[model samples]
Target: MLILPILLAFQTAEGSGYKTNDFALLGSDGKKYTVKTLTKGKPVFLVNLYDMEGSQGIADLNRLSQMTMGKVRVVGLTTLSTRGRGLARVKELGVRFLVLGSDDPYSILDIVPRLVIKEAGSVSYLSNTLLLPDRRLTHVWEGYNRWTLKRMSQDALKYGHVRLKIDFSRFPEKLQRGYGEFYGLGPG
Candidate 1:
């Protein structure tokens, strides 16, 4: 009896204040960005990519860009130097989304402390994390998945740190089809 009630309260607290102390990366068109500054008052969708030459990375960016029509601010962070080759690739792909170069994966390091010392290789940075506009991390996915990416976009639109201009009903058909599928609404 008491156990059930205690669990419910714990869940509530988790949702309310789980995101904090996280950071993101932002860049583009020769502009530099600081995660600490960009998330000052808005939610952020931070994507870390190391292999920009791959098919999945390109596809992911394209899909994310479509959802970015003033919905969520998407930023791409890469470990490779964006010099002649990398720069041309990103620009040709029309990476209008912000792109940042990592002096170190400082953004990820600040949040997942273990990831900092872990001896993982390419697989590690491929993971993504979501942070609220005010630098609160709302969700984290250990690996890459389309469904999770889509859900993060939905959460940003629905309960984002900053309010959206249009109503949920006014959202495009693609967006409205599966709104709030993750939460599975029940008693608060």
Candidate 2:
């Protein structure tokens, strides 16, 4: 009993071990933004899409924008080159939040759909990544479900004025397993 509580307390204090990388991308609104600038000191929820043309992706972005408004900053990253039709599709979506075009060598396309949580410009958590080809879920992280959404909202409200700290151990067993797998502890 005491050991469990002690472990939870220690885990909470250690914080999530993910970090944000540096990159500047042009937004659909014709402005340039960086990951650090957009997230600033607040917690951010990022969704990376292979392209902006998918209706499901657009709907997800819109829904997330509304659900996280004023509580957590929501940003969309598109791996598709944002030159002609790609940029046009983003404009058509008319998403209220920021949508950035990524031209980085390691595009989101290489990986699956991901939900990244960042606090004070560093990644606090990275949710389970979904394999995009067949839409198969690898279950490697812990922020892509309804429970996580609610928890993130509550956390944002509670820690809006302070630096955020997430206790990963408090999450469900599945999430813990995913986290372990992501770090190569359990199974690959």
Candidate 3:
């Protein structure tokens, strides 16, 4: 009996479709910004990672930031309070993109490390939802894969008016191999 309500809550908590609620967050630069302001009529790649120390999440964000530089607006959102070491980690990571503080009033923290794309002022795609159990990644939904990255790049080109071409040759050998394995391009 109790399980039914729990399941219902979980279902409603997921932001799978379009989002209407605008986010107002403090950026790592100590400035408050809204989603629309940051996007500025561009396609946005929004990464939501609650745990600052998630290695995979950090690596993926770093790669995306480098790949989409000057093409798409890459923003990192975190629900964790950036009151202490959280702030330090943001600087230490040397993140080239804006890392904003997310105040999730809707309780969708479970479906985080998510990739949300916005085009022309509305959410066009949401993927890579991970649900963690006891700080351990238990579920991964179509995220950190080559297909998704390719699709995101395509969308940015189609909607954001991005003209920068993706030069995979610039990526490190390790990343190239990782992408190959994820997209089945090179020897697996």
Among all candidates shown, the one with the greatest lDDT: 1
Per-residue error for 116 in candidate 1, Å, reads 8.7
User: lDDT for each of the candidates?
Assistant: 0.49, 0.46, 0.47
Clashes of each: 3, 1, 0
- Cα lDDT of model 1 by residue, 1-188, tens digit: 88766533311211324554544333545655565666545676666554455434445555565556565677665654455555676877767676665445344444443221122222334445566665555555433444455556556766674433323232332211111111123344
- Give per-residue lDDT, candidate 2, residue 18: 29
Mind giving the per-residue lDDT tens digits that candidate 2 earns over 71-137? 5666666655565665777767776677667566235433232233222222213332312112222
Q: Highest TM-score among the candidates is held by which one?
A: 3
Q: How does model 1 score by TM-score?
A: 0.57
What does the lDDT read for residue 77 in candidate 2? 64
TM-scores, all candidates, are 0.57, 0.53, 0.58
lDDT of 3 by residue, 42-64 (tens): 56666554445553456556766
The parts of candidate 1 lying over 4 Å away from their true place are: 1-26, 83-85, 92-94, 103-122, 143-146, 157-188
Q: Which stretches of candidate 2 lie over 4 Å from their true place?
A: 1-15, 103-143, 155-188
Order of quality (lDDT): 1, 3, 2
Q: In candidate 3, list every pair of residues with a backbone clash.
A: none
- Model 2 worst lDDT window (10 residues): 175-184
